[model samples]
Target chain A: MFGFCADPDTLGNVAWMACYLTTGKHMAIYLSVGTVLLLLAITAPAALAFGFAGASAARSRILPLSWLGRGYIAVVRGVPDIAFFLFFVIALDQFFEWIRHEVKCPDWDQPIRQGNDFVVCAEAKLPLGNAAQWVHETYGFFLAVLTFAIVFGAFAANVLYGAMRAVPRAQMETAEAYGMSPRQCYWRILVPQMWVYALPGLSNLWMVLIKATPLLFLLGVEDIVYWARELGGAKTARFTDYPHGDWRMWYFLALLVFYLLFTRVSEIVLDRIMKRLTHGQATSGGEAQRKAA
Target chain B: MSCLQTIADYGLRSIGIGERLLPREDFTLCQQFTLIGSGMIWNVYFGLIALLTGFFLATAVALGKASSNPLARKPSEWFIFVFRGSPLFIQFFFAYFAFLSLKSVSPIFDPFTSAWLGAAIVLFLNTAAYSGEIFYGALLSIPKGDTEAADAYGFSGLTKFRKITWPTMLRLAWPAYTNEAIFLFHATTLVYFSGFPAWRQKGDALYYANYFADKTFNPFVPYPILAGYFILVTLVIITVFGLVNRRLNRHLPQESRGRLKMRMNLIR
Candidate 1:
């Protein structure tokens, strides 16, 4: 990152530290934070959309749709999420490649699963085996995002479903008496009012999502956890210019501090948002606001 | 080999009891199921013990947090804040490395560096913090009239807590605690992935699943088998906790008693 970063061994104390921190691997570590943020930015809305559909389906009058939604929520809740993460990434990947194999290799009739191997054709390979490094990285990241969205979506669905139910029956009845259609009342009144109730649960979920980002390393993504483990292992003089003893403890300590700071900032922002959202509702926070004014 | 024979050879593989070497080639479905099922023992061990132990500690910590005394309250508050503020993944890594460092400084501490202790300690602490928050919420929501009634009858401190506060907290927190137990079981999959090395192939469910996935380059079988085992364990947890919850709230009037509703919103 700086001109003095060249010849790390020759550099003095502060300079060596600067160069040490600016190594190519360190750059990757910094980039992984961006990856974590990018994941949050993408997964939050995707999961919200999934949650919205799920909540709507769960509330549906149709029995089968409600069952499907209920089952989706139940299955995810019943299993450990890490199990789903490990399962879905592989399962989804195979499902995608299997579909592609059927489409791209119509002439090749041998089983896609021969004995123990999952041999998809060259064209059917996700990101293709010969593709650039960036494509592979992106593909892995995309899978992680999808996995996160699926797991957190179940959680968000539970929250939103509760929030929907918590919307007072009298409010809906009033809307109904005012000549509003069921759909119109749902959109104009219930949806708008439910968010104040949802905000607290959603804020909690956001903190959880932040904490879960570290699991990206387990999905084969070169995330911060991966970088910390890679860079902080004992590096002998033979292996690299900057010889260091076991520093994984320090690296992970840094990660711990990073996460604590991240969660703290999130708490502050979410609290502000909660206060704003509760400004004029019938909830306790809303009533407190009115009394204080 | 027959499935029974395969089970006999590898059913205790995760604990290094029967199989010395894992099947490298010619992996079969039966082997995957047997070995992965064996690995589930560790997951169950980690989840069950942690949840059981964490329950009492969580109750105590929650009570401490709700106490008027700053000496008791402050430590409990800080404990929850530290554990809840950081990611469990980082906690595992930090703890494993910290244990490793301790082992070097004192050879007597080497046994403590093992996964069974190190991972359990972290999970215990992590779950305690999470369930502490839930119990604290439940404690706060306990009806004032119940406490007043206890006071009117000369029930105070320990007696009051035993009669009123404890049961009410357990009843209110049961649903949330059930969710916490489920997530902790899920978190057991993370033990091997963190800094704790799976010595002698003695690892948890996801560990063996990953091993099979790597050897076969096919994740379709082993991972799902692990998931199945976990789903079964989760159901068992819900059933057991639900029964306990029923027992806790058994004395209350039917209309007055709050039902044990599973809310899956909170994650720790």
Candidate 2:
């Protein structure tokens, strides 16, 4: 923020506008975009890891693990994901606190669920009772990211599970014939080949993820959507040096444009990645390229 | 209260018909199931109406996009891109705010600020754009030979489209369109969560589910019940669409008819 923001009322139109935009709240709003991106950066990989575990679990020879994995994927499929987003975050938080309360408060005799309230000892609190503001925010954000990863991990698992199967049965058999262990067959043949198949779904999941970042606001994070509503609401003449009518429409328009551009760029990048993955592969895309060459 | 008594009081609670005040304490499993199930009426209302209306408009949009005239093509194309490109969550907020802004200029737009009309309109447009693209893709893939055969005959323009192109487009787009319908149902859950406040707590299934989650601080019960209801609805949708799909492909030979396999592709 430029320091010339002292007398917003006395300043000219362009100067006043500049100063108004440089307000502390506006700066926080600007940084919220970074928060959105940071979430995407962290959640994408986390979700991928969860998906990999899930896919691997589903494919496991062991019965319970496969059932767990398949159930994870199938159950998540039927419900609205927004329901899961709202449900899992609270459920997980409570489950964690209940565990912590049990560990820390063995002597306490009071029931944890007293009527409508979920009460716990002070130490059982997620970030501790006297934690810093940043810690609470971080904890909430962490829960949100976890929720996103879990919901989307199911989707990604669906994609990856299919992609894993899409790798021909022949390829795995050939790996076994060549004296490779099942693990070797998986790692060497299936894993590498699954990428091209997974790319389309993964890329789609990425777009859905990017679009879903707005839902962080629902989870009580000060995400871009939250800030847009906060900053864009009408400021009374008594409230600030700068008075503005309701500008939520404009704020939301900016968000729409931001998402549009993000998805457009992602599409271009994913298209390029697809081309590279398809090169010399047996798919029709690769066949066309081979014919052209 | 007995379970039957509780159901009697709260059965139509979601539509503002019964139980003016929601149950605050001593929640029963039966009460949870009854109220949430009642709330599903709104979900069905929003989804069915949106899909029903969007289906007709989507065909127009698909035809518009396929038209050689840029005048007709551009708007439909842009409509598809904007709606299909953005998240439905943001679209809901943006639409609600946009409707609010329009209210002062004309009283005609007043009802749009309400959740029922406004949210339904957004869902309608969203599904339209999604199904439009699906229809457009199907239009593009319509075999040239069929069109040529029509051309070779006296069939042209309206007659050509009515007799030949329309059936083919519907047949091709049916599978993707079915997925879009399911996705729309999933999307109706976001309506209450977005900027639109549920008028007097007359809300969708997820709204009531969220209410129970808040009250009891136990998510395990209400959410799963809601999911069960949704899965039941989804199964019904699949069956209904499968029948329609069969009808669409009825003219084709048995071997050539398309199989109605369900794929959970997120449409629009």
Candidate 3:
């Protein structure tokens, strides 16, 4: 915000619009955009780590680990991700609480699921029942982040699995012939060569991850979608100083345009990165660039 | 009541045919299956109708995007870009609000505010944009020799497109299009969860799944049921699409045929 004359009603249309945009709630909306970007920044790497583990496990020498990894990937693929969003937030919370309850409330005899309520001991409650509001909010956000990481991790695993397979056999064989162990071959040769194959799928996943941030509202993170609904609703003089009719359509339109621009910019940037990654590589893209050069 | 009785009572409950009220207490596995199974009708309806209708628009859009004329190309390009670029969740909310605004202007648009029509229209446009891009890629890849042979046979314009171009595009695009169909069906779950209200509790599978989850406070049962239903449908989709892929690629020799690999990683 800009400093202006303090009187709200006396402001002209231009000043009113400026004040409306700078209001506390609007500031929250702006901050929520950071929350989305933060989520992407955090979830992308975390999911990639999870994906690498899953992909490795799926390709493991041990049969059960491979089955477990493959099952995790397959489960998420079949279900609509929003279902997982809704389910995992609660399920994971309950799971954590159950662990806590087991340790903290060992003497308690009552079942945790009593009819409909999940009755964890107060000590087992996430963020504690008496915790500050921000604590609760942070806990919810943490759960959302984890939920996203797990679901998207499965997708990433699928991509990475394919990419790993796509690394030319001769490359791995060359690593083996040079007296490298299997682990060394995996890290030194196989992983390095898989990036070009994985980039297209990973970029697409990044876009999906970007698009999925709005579902943070469904997970109760007070993200942009939540703010859009909150601020854009019909406000009467009884509610606030800046009374206006429902402007949700305009707000949503703004969100749409934001996403469009974001995706378009990302597409351009990803294309550049893809080109850079493909340079001197064996893929078709590299061949094309080689021909052009 | 028995599972059979539960099925009888709530089998068509999603369409408001049988049960007047959803089970309020003591949730059973049968109830979860029946109610959620009942709700699959809507998902099937939305996905099938959208894919069927979107096919034609997608073809037109693909051709338009590939056209040499800027007048024809620009709009199609932007249409595909706008729809493909944004989240379908936002699209649902934005479309619902737009429909609500339109409904205020004229009662003729009243029905558009509901999930059945408004959501379907959004899904239709969204899938059309995606499938359009796929078809456009296929169109670009249509062999030069195939078209040259058509030209030699004096085929041009609509006749050439109908005879040689369109079928080849479909064949080439079929695998990607199959994935799009699966994605669309998965997306139908977002309808009720978004801005659109499920009128009188008539909603798709996820809606009932959410309802049961809310009531039972045990997500393990209902969500898995929903996932099972979805997996079954996904298999059916893959099978049906595989059949179509087979038919389209029938003219090719056995080994040269493109198999329908469900690369579910491409898009949501």
Candidate 4:
């Protein structure tokens, strides 16, 4: 990244450190932070949408739809979400490949599950066998995103459902008296008013989502945790230019500091958001706002 | 082999007692159920011990946070902040590496280096912080009237705390505490994934599930079985906590008493 980074091995002290920090692997580490942020940006709204759908379905008038929604919420609530994360990535991958296999290989006679291997046709492989290296990485990242959305979506659903219920019954009655339709009341009154209640839970969820980004490494994405482990391991002279003893402790410490900083910033932002959401509202924060104003 | 035989062979497999090698090929429903069910022993072990131990520490931390002195208040506040601020996954890795380094420095601490001690300590501290926050919230929300009534009756210090404060705190915090307990159980799945290495292939449910997934290259069987086992464990936790919640509220009149509603808010 700098002109002085030409010879990392020959340079001494500050120069060596400068070159080492700008190595290609370090660039990947920097990029992985972007990956974590991108994941948060994408998954937040996606999970919110999923949660909205879930909350709505749970409140549906139809018995089966309501049951289906309630069941979805209940099941996810009961199990450890990491189990779902581990389950869904592989299950979804196989489900996709199996679908593709049926479509792409009509003449193939061998069973897809032969003994231990999931032998999908070559064309049916996710990202395909011939895809670029980036495709594979991106595919894994996408799966991680999906897994995150699904797990956190259930949590968001629980929060949003509670928030939706917390919307004053009298307000709904007033909307009815005004001759507004159920849908209009839902969209205009309930949804708008619910944000004040939801904001607290949603902000908490955002912190959790931010913290959860490291689990992307478990999903096979070369995330910050992956990079930390890769870069911080004892590098022998046989393997690389800079040989060092096991520095995983330091790497994890760096990750811990990074997360602590991220969460602290998030706390500040979420507090501001709560204040904004509560402005002139009837909640406790709103009372403070009124007093200040 | 029959289901009974499968159970006998793999029931203690997670503890490294049964089959030398995990079933690799020609997987069956019985095998999936048995092996995953066996793996759940580790999850339950981790959750129960952590929750049991964390409960007391959480109470203390909650009290510390609510203390009049800044000396008590500050450390409790920082403890909650540090643990609650970071992900449990990172906490596990941070803890494992920290323990590993400590083990290198002093071999006498090898017991602490193992997953059982290391992971439990992390979980204990993690859950304590989370539950401490819940208890702190409950403490703040304790009715002023109740405390004044206790003061009016000449109750002071430990007597005031025992008679008026602690019970109310427990009652008020019970619902949120239930959520924390559930999440803590869920967090046990993370133990093997963190920096801690499983000795002799002894690990939690997700670890064994991952093992089968890798071996079979077919995730369908093992993962669901693992999920089912967890779902059962979760149900048991809910039932037990619900019983405790009921007992906590038993003193109040039926109309005034809060029901033990299972709210799935993620505390961890």
List model 4 lDDT by residue over B57-99, tens digit each.
9999999999999999999999999999988898888888777
Better of 2 and 4 by DockQ: 4
Candidate 1: clashing pairs of residues? none
True contacts kept of 1: 0.73
For residue A128, model 3's alpha carbon misses the true position, in angstroms, by 0.8
For A200-290, candidate 4 gives per-residue lDDT tens digits of 8888889888888888888888889999888988888887876778888888888888999999998998888887888888777789879
Q: Model 3 off-target regions past 4 Å? A: B266-268
Predicted structure 1: lDDT: 0.88
Estimate the lDDT of model 2.
0.90
**Can you list each candidate's DockQ?**
0.63, 0.64, 0.68, 0.65
The better candidate by DockQ, 2 or 3, is 3
Predictions: Cα RMSD each: 2.4, 1.8, 1.5, 2.2
Worst 10 residues of 3 chain B by lDDT: B259-268
**Across residues A1-293, which tens digit of lDDT does each residue of candidate 2 receive?**
56677767777889988888888898998899999999999999999999999999999999999999999988887788888888988998998999999999988899888878889999998989899999999999999999988988888999999999998888889899999998899898999999999999999899889888888988989989999899889999898878998889888988999888899899999999999999988778889999999
TM-score, cand. 2? 0.96
Q: Estimate each model's TM-score.
A: 0.93, 0.96, 0.97, 0.94
Clash count in backbone of candidate 4:
0
Report the lDDT of model 2 for residue B60.
95
Q: For model 1 chain B, where is the 10-residue window of minimal lDDT? A: B259-268
User: Which one is best on TM-score?
Assistant: 3
Return the candidate ranking by lDDT, descending.
Answer: 3, 2, 1, 4
- Candidate 1 stretches greater than 4 Å from native: A1-15, A62-64, B265-267
lDDT of 4 at A67: 88
lDDT of 2 by residue, B29-89 (tens): 9999999999999899999999999999999999899989999999998998898788888
Give me the chain B TM-score of candidate 4: 0.96
